[model samples]
Target chain A: MYTRTLFIDGQEDYPLTNRKEVARLAGVSEATVSRVLNGIGPMKDSTKKRVLDAAKQLNYELNAVASSFARGRSGNLGVVMPHVPKVHLFSTYYFSELLSGIGEAVRSKGYGLLLLFRDPAAEFDYVSLYRTQRVDACLILGASAIDSEIAGIHRLAEASLPFCVMDQRFEHSGLSIVAADHEQGSYDAVRHLIDGGCTRIGFLNGSPQYSNSQDRHEGYLRALAEAGIEPDESIFYEGNYSRTSGRRAAEAVYRDLGRLDAIFVGNDRMAIGLMQALREKGCRLPDDLKIVAYDDSDAASFTEPPLTTVKVPFYDMGRLAADKLLARLTDKDQTDGVINEKLQTELKIRKSSGN
Target chain B: MYTRTLFIDGQEDYPLTNRKEVARLAGVSEATVSRVLNGIGPMKDSTKKRVLDAAKQLNYELNAVASSFARGRSGNLGVVMPHVPKVHLFSTYYFSELLSGIGEAVRSKGYGLLLLFRDPAAEFDYVSLYRTQRVDACLILGASAIDSEIAGIHRLAEASLPFCVMDQRFEHSGLSIVAADHEQGSYDAVRHLIDGGCTRIGFLNGSPQYSNSQDRHEGYLRALAEAGIEPDESIFYEGNYSRTSGRRAAEAVYRDLGRLDAIFVGNDRMAIGLMQALREKGCRLPDDLKIVAYDDSDAASFTEPPLTTVKVPFYDMGRLAADKLLARLTDKDQTDGVINEKLQTELKIRKSSGN
Candidate 1:
């Protein structure tokens, strides 16, 4: 019961060092010392006064230490992430690059990285983390554009806390966001396929809950319209941005392959899976079908015939988000303004795109 | 006991001030309060009820984080590792597997894991982490047997702090160590090669600084001696555990190809480099030169001729190390001794070893 504030274990607050000594000096049991030192609860005034006087005399770094993390700084940068069991999230190139970037910047400031995993579907209070936890600043990863998530982020914004969200977009919410230009990336990738004389292109994107996916969808549509090609909603597919999901979409894509000559995938994992599944279905790479993928993960180059991928600057995005949030924390002159940073993405044209 | 519904703080769930308040109300020691509240470690029923009643009385928010370390420690487990630029450590099979295990264990304990990267050659103070920072316990990964590292670990042991070293040996130092049975694995791998009717076997080893490498050397020599085949030191080669280093050994290995039929490599990375270089030199795998390597990394199976390798239980070692160190922190009566746990390893038979 080290001062339970709105925050859990008061996230950053350290309990008093030697409670036994203070209890003995106050002529009270350690429990009583604890109750009285809280400066609240059902403790009698005399007991509270005695404990306070003893604590003052002992001065066990209590005044400067207690509630410092909750109200002040705890020297930790909290990174909020989705808790997916058994998936070693960092093993993924996207997470590995992003985390390494955050680690580099956090190291420069000599700050500890506190990773907090929450079930994105569960009811978690994001605002309380800022109000009571020891985390001086926080950066949220993989935020979705869902109502519950938006409301949660809204609370954090309303409180005027120092935080930044990576990838996900909350337009006009005044929240700090660092992301790659996925819309432009997808547009460029699809245009390349069009330029290569591929008139019929299929778009496979992730869940619409992610703003990036929605942005990618818009880009895909824009590119097709600009080419004066009629939209083929029947050939457009949606995945969960997982390799398995991409594999699942292969059946649908295969059925419509006669009409579709090329496919643009949301991320490299999905592209790899799609390619693998397509190969199993006896489809020839770049001959019968051409492909383009996003994210450009390490596996992109290893895939058969390789992958023409859009390289999102996830590392730079993570670094920029952390840097801006950190500047808000340590830099007093830093004023309040919506920090909307959109880093550029590059195209890595490999053999898969028939280039 | 008050109802938990009446939260005096608007945002925070519970109306509790501190666990000391709950302890005072329960008329018990703070440590007893911690043990009962955690519901994780061993505790008496009477103590549990008392702590529960106290919590109910104060409307305290009962959580693992709030009261688990009421003794004033930062609720972080610092993971110290060597920092190499642009390497993306977590992307590697060894680091990714080990870290995932550590992450799983840490989550189960409701503690934050803090990653601290140190330049191996630069002077670093491990003791300051426990003394100044909030980290209650620590675990070191990829520690080498150097004077500086040993002295650094010695200081932590001298302080009698809760710490564990993963996959390293500090013989007779009484430091807690969790490592895989590399020597036995090497023995088994070599025996496999001998059982394949290879009379003249070459050995490609990593740097001897690591105790595991030394163990592998011993295992290799023992297997040869057991086979009554005179050990040939001239054909034995060493690398610095880099793919380039393994490639560097290919020239010497190629020159001795006429004298040797099989080779036992220290790790998959080196084995891969050797295989790639040997292949470039027009050496056919298994048919021309049988090979056995250690550490069945992700790339092990992806090689042109998949490697026959030893699978070290790095994940299990990491999980066990974290679990043991975490227990020592929460368990008051837990006594310390030389904790040396050696997990087993398995040999995977693939195309590279004439299997």
Candidate 2:
């Protein structure tokens, strides 16, 4: 029967129960429980038994997930995700697959998952989860590579806490990251289009906050340069990797569809929308707008003319991040320095690529 | 009825190896499975084969009593979900929306989300969570209604703990439940189809574990009764609310499609797959067959004809469950027994309904 109705809207806020709850349940003073648990003060046998029983029943020792782990830990791994309204991040193929992978690996390791949604527009704090004993380590789903994000991780790096990022890469060295090689994926996609007798190939990428978008852009330019085709900014369109945004870009893309023979679109969702919009405008796929999409999601095959896209191992990436982080936590594998593991991306050729 | 787990960005209609899920998987009586496990009765080899396949699909161990590590003061709200292997549970629109809503409400109330995935085939032990103090209050996502679940929840109810379930219902009174009026949604969908001159309307529904499936089945029958149309078993198909299952059911559905003018599908994913398969078999959409699906997921609008689907407020249900549980935790609302609530569903008339 503890009551503190004052709700804190802090980004790093942890749940508020303390030893007070345990003390109340055990009918013992807070000092006695704390001293007994911490092994700092002496107590009578009867007092010890009462406190111990309550503590044991309450899992007050914080031993969870991995039974092998020592006491004084919550035994939970935190997954920090950005709560962007309307995006439906969790439903997306990239996120869903990665999360499934993470769940699989985490479950195997016997650790509980603590899901914390971060407000993108708010302040960032990574240490509070550790300080509050809410999670022993965390895996950040991502967000863009903005100043705040970089700064937040930078603070985390300084704190020297155990955590890693999935899919997104920050420039900071020695920061653990598990991601797909979008640069190589994009390069292959563009190169395939170029080799397929397409001269003026345009490109559509996503938000600049995701570091991989820049990699994709660079790959786009590299493929163009390698094929001796000059890069044109006029042919480039940006989308937030949403199908709606892809449809919206159809007007601009169609205006330049005359100049460009093919365009390498970002993810498959945007590709689906862009293709549908172009189809609505009487643009025959491949003939009017040959395209190569990224992230060969489930929707790829579901599209009218099935999309040819780069398949990123999102699930494996998720699993790898969790496996690495958990191993680090357990001191199982002591391989040093920024455990950077980049999985390969395969380009799945289908009807959309006219292959 | 859905024996297959489709790997296509997945899914719906499963909880795991409990008596309900096991019975569901085995297509045998739950009592039979229990007797077999408890060595209370004899069973045939075919029954044993069914259970083995389920274990193979899950790559999971048979039921084991979850060892309790009770202790606490983590100051968190535990969200209990079945960790169904090979099914991308989080990626499905239903789960993601519900979780997002839960996340939002929990965040606003300044409580941490402790996500615990129960191995579907494991023994139910909810009391351990509270006894361990991992969570002050918990919200169960769901599984089918089974005896062990009821017993576990019965113990919780006896414990007089404040908890609730989302989008699921049990027979016991005084259990807080927040769910969608699926019966209403199904009724509206079928009635609309019937009013549009569809006499021979087929139905594709999910598993029986989900009580809503029964509601939907009832709704389908009610609509038929109102229209003075005899309900035919041959016109009914079962899917796990998965796109792949939908496609698989297409063979059987299409065999009987000559008699049916329209069909009411269980969910959007199944509709997409069913439609795709039907189209592949040289059936024209809306003209040859009309469809009204459930769950207006993002993919609902992305289908070639854009599904005419019933939009269920999954996110709101998630929010309500979290909000109510948290409110109860804070003692802000002294509401009485069994706060049962259901939200409305809307039928979105897209081209697929031939409107």
Candidate 3:
């Protein structure tokens, strides 16, 4: 008997024998025993059963690291998210929807998801995950075009790791990116508001750190130019995409609510907050002011009078990102070129747009 | 020169050399090179810089599997959640808040989170994760006391794995659990409503499959009994803790809206939906009927009339659960017994309860 302490369920010790002893007891070669234990290859049912029975009788336990070493795969995909304290990424509709899509896609592919949060302020080594073999491939999310983030992308690119970026585009042409057509979505939203007879429209946009926000701003400008409406910089208030910021922006916009016939808010969350603040100030929807928002999240339909917004398929974007990475991981020949997939967005008409 | 193709960012081939070659170039022993690469032990700053610079110059990449095998640890924690297709767990405020808390705690500990979704209806092997050494410890979330889930818990318990359940308590006594004191929260919410001069109060609850719902039900009954008011089963409606279900529940409660003075809802999502439905039916909030909800989510304050509800600390619960599991993982001697922690909840008074 090879008696040694074994930790099971973090509790009591269990007696166990060595694999060699189990092999001897089962009347099989040690290599056969190893194969059966590791589920390495196809074997005769009788031989596998005999080996298993002997191992169980002797209480033989297989070491996890040895098996992983023999298998040559960690069987997990990595999702690296930007860690912002007090931001509550999971609670936000954008992250949650995108994560849902990633989870769904990863599960369907029979791969476990390894989530790692990287603080933008701290020094992070992205290649360490691949080098340490914790994750087979990684998907980067919520990455801005900051110096460190750009350097991290280049590091991964230099190392030749299998990875994808969700919603963020890099200057590197070879980087794999899955993003929504925010410009088109914004254009449609502004066009909808323009068609509704709004001449002087205010634009409440998110921070420029994100590529999507920039695209949305461009769309807003393009729509105004096409409509022959001069872009008013004073009415364009930048927000951080939070409901509180939206409420604050509403205050700024309210000072010039007389000149502004309608407003194009960046996302539905801010739009909802803006509506609440405007209502508290005695402004009625569609009667006094009309609004068009983006990102048709779950709250859009439930908002008072509902919100007319552009729907960004965050879930699909996540799924596509995961699928693309998985494909690269599985197909050796497929891992050679850049893949830039820009998914389509739809306009959902609701009561807030004066429809 | 030995040349071989390598995948970098799932793209074209990159030239790379082995660790041994880099070690030779750096004029250091291979053991020193390994130490510098794995970040296992402290080395002289000059030697560490030399090794890294040489590796970077030569483009040396470490093999992930061999390093993991040598380290004898996965450096990851497992979180198993119930899989409900199209349900979008991330979109739900409950799961998202909890995950945020878990993520924050896990990242602070310098541990990676490995997420796995198990189908409730299918047979799942929970022990494989630990047995295969994929994760150091596991945390089970959203698990009901279904036969399979209970069996999974027992399997983990039998194996003596370092694990904890979040929000769900099993029949087994020795299982570690971290959850909110929902019964007390419910009691507080109902008591607050009763103190507001509302005598006939209806109960809108979630499915009984979850233990929290049962506790909330008990609290509702207990509060009614203490107030000397008979509980009306006719006014009770069941929802799936969704805004849509809440809207549907409002229809059933509307028939007796004349008789009911107030209603206690299971969560803020349902309460928001129920209020929308009631408003559409021309019912004045706090004038025709007052409402008290559970889970003071972000949307709770933004809802029309603003919900007065029981504040369930989901983020704190997640953080506490992660902390407990991490403690068990790090402390070998502390894993002998079960730890069941029930966190306290707070009541947030707002406009919806006529406060």
Candidate 4:
């Protein structure tokens, strides 16, 4: 008889036999069974068959979600992102990293992620998950400049639903926010460009609609003012935060090329686009033009010239946000100062910026 | 008197109200107010304010979910994906397209999505959702060659949790499945590659442990057999269907560069990665290394040499899965189908393969 121990929710449940049990029955290890599972590990194919045959005789239930729920937790999380559907394709790499961070955080917390794309066009309500109680709490990703999202969170608070916002710099009286210090990060990026001896700089701004975009623009101006260089309004161009927009902005700059020697791109996607445009125009990076982009996405590192960009602490943000939400949920009268956590961004100097 | 029309659980309740009765609300149409309440059309900022102020003054309660629930519908459909913790950068595109499909499908049905991730290390039971009454039905994604998922679904079936699987070529009894015809798609890719005058072709396969991967691999062999070429063992490599693995596999192929003149990558991510690697080595695309990839994600068109890939009916898969689950949920006895839906794949030829 094969016997294996398995956790059902938090309690032990006995099943007929799993590969682990088969391994136990054969006086081997689970790793040996894993080899059979993948058909790659060092176990002979014949031994793998014996383990499988032993397991076939004993039926085992391997549904983790059901077992976890039995332990008094659904092992599920409610993740709310701005229901802006158009933003995904243009900015996948950024959100991909964010998802990776949140996924890692949730897994550590012994929970699985349940994505809730709050349709911006629809009523901003968390009731779909809240009323049914599918998740323990919510993590709101990129909740910046969207007033309705804040309003929705306020409603959640009234309903006693716990949630924490990520990457949004807001000083609301009772809101919990975890974010990267974009102003300081932007300040550092511009300072690096200025120190590299590029006086005439262009700011490729994202649409000033988003609060984070506004902060980055403000940071750019602050850096210029601190350096005693008058802010150049003529060099600033506001566009959508996309590679296509980045390419267009770079082309716009190139049409009047001599006026600007360096450009600060809003995001890495746009930054890569801008660099591609510059390269197509036969402009040598760092020699002819200096580039500094924000958001060190996977594409940023793999760009033709490795990008010089600011890295946001997505992992830290996710963990801290989860912690904050959990804290607020447990403590009823714990409302005081807004739990605003600012993670510092690192300036990664690479070939594009002559670093 | 303030008059308001409240729709609760599909039952209309009208409370009579005058503009002065709700407080001296200025210059807002009742239609605009209704639109905002129903989450219908956009309203001017000032108009939105006047209506909200009036509603607040009248002490009107907004119950979005309750109304939907009153109709004996939860207005939520569950989405289940394999609990792979790592973020596939391209999943941003995959998810967006899928949600768009589901969104359109359920828009008329008045349902929202309940996205859940299954932990690969954890069990796969979905009975908790049923116990909590969170969603009506589930759409399972990425259940590849693993027969355990089928057994899990059978358990869910026993528990009366409706579910439908996508992208896998499984025809389990008493289950509904939506999948792309990868066998024919792979045949098309190989035929195209052969037509391009490539005799020695390399295959960047996905984890062969999967049923879909096995089907695609079999298709490749079938195509080779049809072409009267001996299916060489040395030209195949298995990898996780990601860009990084694609690049690594390309590098492996580059080490034995002259043996193969073309490559067929399992997914778009891998195809893009392989293209980048080949480009880095100054290998001319199509002219030197013709390529064909699968899953025409957004990045496919944006690759250096735009990818020539197969477009899976991703949106249709999502929709069909939703429909099947909904059918089962509406009436259990009505869900009698070995619904083996094989959606067609479109061959998108672009600059990468010199199309």
- List fnat, each candidate: 0.23, 0.24, 0.45, 0.06
Tens-digit lDDT track of model 3 for A127-201: 666655567788888888778788878878777778888887788767889999999889999999999889888
- For all predicted structures, in order, the TM-scores are 0.77, 0.80, 0.85, 0.73
Ordered from best to worst DockQ, the candidate numbers read 3, 1, 2, 4
lDDT of 2 by residue, A37-119 (tens): 53222246577678778876776642221121123256678888887776666778877888788888877775678887777
| Displacement of the residue A262 alpha carbon in candidate 1, Å | 3.3
Pairs of residues at least 3 apart in sequence or in different chains that clash in candidate 1: A1-B18, A1-B19, A9-B66, A12-A134, A31-B24, B1-B57, B2-B57, B74-B134
Angstrom error at residue A227, model 1 = 2.8
RMSD of each: 10.2, 17.3, 8.5, 11.1
Off by over 4 Å in 3: A1-64, B1-64
Writing each residue's lDDT as its tens digit, candidate 1 over B1-355 gives: 1001111112133333466788898899876775465433334557767888887777764443233223345667888877777666666667767877887788778677878776666444565555443467888887888876776788777777778888878754668888888888999999999999998999999888788889999899889889998998898999978777899999999999999889999998888889878988999987889999999975676465778999987777788888888888778666465567989999999999998
Residue B91 error for model 4, in Å?
4.8
Ranking by TM-score: 3, 2, 1, 4
lDDT, candidate 3, at B189: 92
lDDT of 4 by residue, B96-196 (tens): 56655664555435455665556544345565444334455777776655556665666776654456667665544666677778988888888888988
- lDDT: worst 10-residue window of model 1 chain B: B1-10
DockQ for model 4?
0.07
Cα-based lDDT for every prediction: 0.76, 0.76, 0.80, 0.65
- Mind giving the per-residue lDDT tens digits that candidate 1 earns over A196-260? 99999999999999999999998888899999999988888989887789889999988998998
User: Across residues B96-171, which tens digit of lDDT does each residue of candidate 2 receive?
Assistant: 8888788888776656787777654544556656644556788888656776567667677666666887777887
